[model samples]
Target chain A: MSTEIDKSKVVLYSYWRSSCSWRVRIALAYKKIKYEYHAIHLLKDGGQQKTDEYAHINPMKAIPALIIDGHIIGQSLAIMEYLEEYRPENPLLPKDLYARAIVRQMMQIIGSDIQPLQNLKVLQTVAEFTGQEEKKAEWAKRWIANGFNGLEKLLEKHSGQFCYGDQVSFADLCLPAQVYNANRFNVDMSHYPLIQKINKHLATIPEFIEALPSNQPDAEVQC
Target chain B: MSTEIDKSKVVLYSYWRSSCSWRVRIALAYKKIKYEYHAIHLLKDGGQQKTDEYAHINPMKAIPALIIDGHIIGQSLAIMEYLEEYRPENPLLPKDLYARAIVRQMMQIIGSDIQPLQNLKVLQTVAEFTGQEEKKAEWAKRWIANGFNGLEKLLEKHSGQFCYGDQVSFADLCLPAQVYNANRFNVDMSHYPLIQKINKHLATIPEFIEALPSNQPDAEVQC
Candidate 1:
């Protein structure tokens, strides 16, 4: 018999400071699309996203749910693809099918492999279970580094100013968000020169600058 | 400064019992795509996937790297999309723009949200950190139920014989693999009748049965 576990709490999440959220934001900025941003305080009021109000806006009860023309779309990658599908003005994926798969491969390294493991909730759960609350940062650092190691190898062949080519595509959008996350967790990037170099290069792009957590209206003031 | 963390072990994983691998397998089977299955043996010989041989094939060192015509594709969802793009025969996604986004959204609820948390490496890491090896099953169940809760609700509006309408889209391919995982973790499914119903129906199909973990060539002998 299975014990009743928590239901209705979904985390295909988009948080104010979440890397996944930044992934969508950067892509949107690259496309030069303007949209209003809402601050769903994840830590305040026991998470505004958990409320019944937010659930109606998004049955999944996740942050970063995009409301386009009264239709709501959840999941960061899905939103990215949707924008690519409908807008097609500023394409984010490569033209070749195989090349597109390559771009997505790198994005998933950050999206699925890294982001989920370092999620704030998952880290809290780990800390509680481990009885070492301070280890949350360590958990985030470890997972980020693991994914970056593979990513560094991946970019060796794919890089030329951006992931998979000179153009700003899906991989470029994902890398900055990951690097921002890696910096938050204080992941040492000396071992990953390519990643560090590419991230530094990306940070200079105006679109990337616009999407940084520090630039967001809802960003917390850090000392 | 971030402490030295484990690196280079990527999880473009395709282990015999892994949930993501099964998703791609079911989709591949559904398309009547015949391909060779190579068992990289995740646990044997100190993880064959970690070796230089496998890295050449996929530097990510993950399992189920699908090599077609000398072009290797990694990531389960990426592989599935690649199939849909290249094959276009027996489509797995809806034709409508918003509908495609919807299909991909559910896949992420499982792929990015659930599967990553319940990954064997992640679970093992949690067990090691928490020193509660037995609680691993509880952890797995908790995440599965959490994702399924939202998934069940999403299905109320979209489901027919499968996850979305009558046609087997990307969401249907991802559902059974997660359901198989839920069963192993003993997640309570009473609240998720739609999911339960869809999975029950999907299992009866020969393609899904052929892709089940127990039927894999590398599967260990059952008592």
Candidate 2:
């Protein structure tokens, strides 16, 4: 089950503020896997991700594509799993099978159920459909609040210091970016205290801090 | 790494037409794992999944929750991974690590990207936001088409007889349900020949046929 890694040539195509890309960055930092960063501007030049070359690298035309083990891996969750399997050191998953499943369940509550509804392209589509730009944030806020309601309840049973009993699992990797997006959308965090507590605790961790969207190379350069 | 399964008590909370639930059903059938089916009717009596008892079982209040190995595992991908790990006999993932990542990449294209955008709750929100019931189908079709465009390209490089090589991996588990959904939304399948081909091939497999929406116990039951 072990795969050899040629770490020198590892590359990550990422955007500064993409919640999905931020998840991968957290995993890479937590696992201490060094990679070349290629910024794909989601807002500049009519969305650089839509370029044919980027599309060739990642058919999904999505951020957080990883070039590792001589293959192009797309999808943040997929990339994180590859990183976990590729470098099992500093493991991002639990050793117990059920705990691992729980961690994944928590991860998907954010990744699949929440983030996709609020990501840039989907938000853009929402704007187009509604013909009201302000509706985008309103749309994002409602879905994030909906997902966080369930997540906060789940966390009440699962949280110790992290999303899954004190371990900085993949679910933790998802939490900060989502909270960041939530704040941007003006989601009322008063209702989800557990999520806020976990997000605040994760802030003090070096790996999580280092992967912050504000710290990425492409964070504030004018588009 | 193996967790003992109490095959007798295995329970699945599912809705017949849910694409996510169908995924777990397919994996269970493929691996010959028997489970008790508890129908969570998504449209009857104000959605059985929203009941307090079901919410307690799955905090996310989502369908396709598996009660196995003394744990209530939520999320279809997580349940499938548990199935793969709990009983590794007819593995749903490829042996090679990189190939496994590719398989997962393919799965998330459908799971995270496509399915979520068009799932019942999201579509319901779409209808509410636009104040037009007809917008639901249009929204679903657009997102499905957007994802299928990328998926068809990925399949071109990866497909042999299924979504990833000749094997019936988890990606293959995801295809039929999505194509079923796409067809439900009246998406033009001519643009995604690879998806159509894989969907066609999956139909011949007994495991897939047995898990089809029409075969589920609750499929045609009246409200």
Q: What tens digits encode model 1's per-residue C-alpha lDDT throughout A29-121?
A: 877776767677778888788887677556667767876644677888888998899789878998899899989998888889998888778
Tens digit per residue, CA lDDT, model 2, A21-85: 99999999988888888899998999899888788888998888988767889999998998999
Clashing pairs in 1: B14-B63, B92-B169
Query: What TM-score, to 2 decimals, does candidate 2 have?
Result: 0.95
TM-score of chain A of each: 0.89, 0.94
State in Å the error of residue B221, model 2: 7.4
For candidate 1, the C-alpha RMSD (Å) to the true structure equals 6.6
Best by TM-score: 2
* Model 1: how far residue A90 lies from native, Å: 1.0
Q: How accurate is candidate 2 locally (lDDT)?
A: 0.89
Q: List the residue pairs that clash in candidate 2.
A: none
Q: Give the poorly placed runs of model 1, Cα more than 4 Å off.
A: A1-15, B1-14
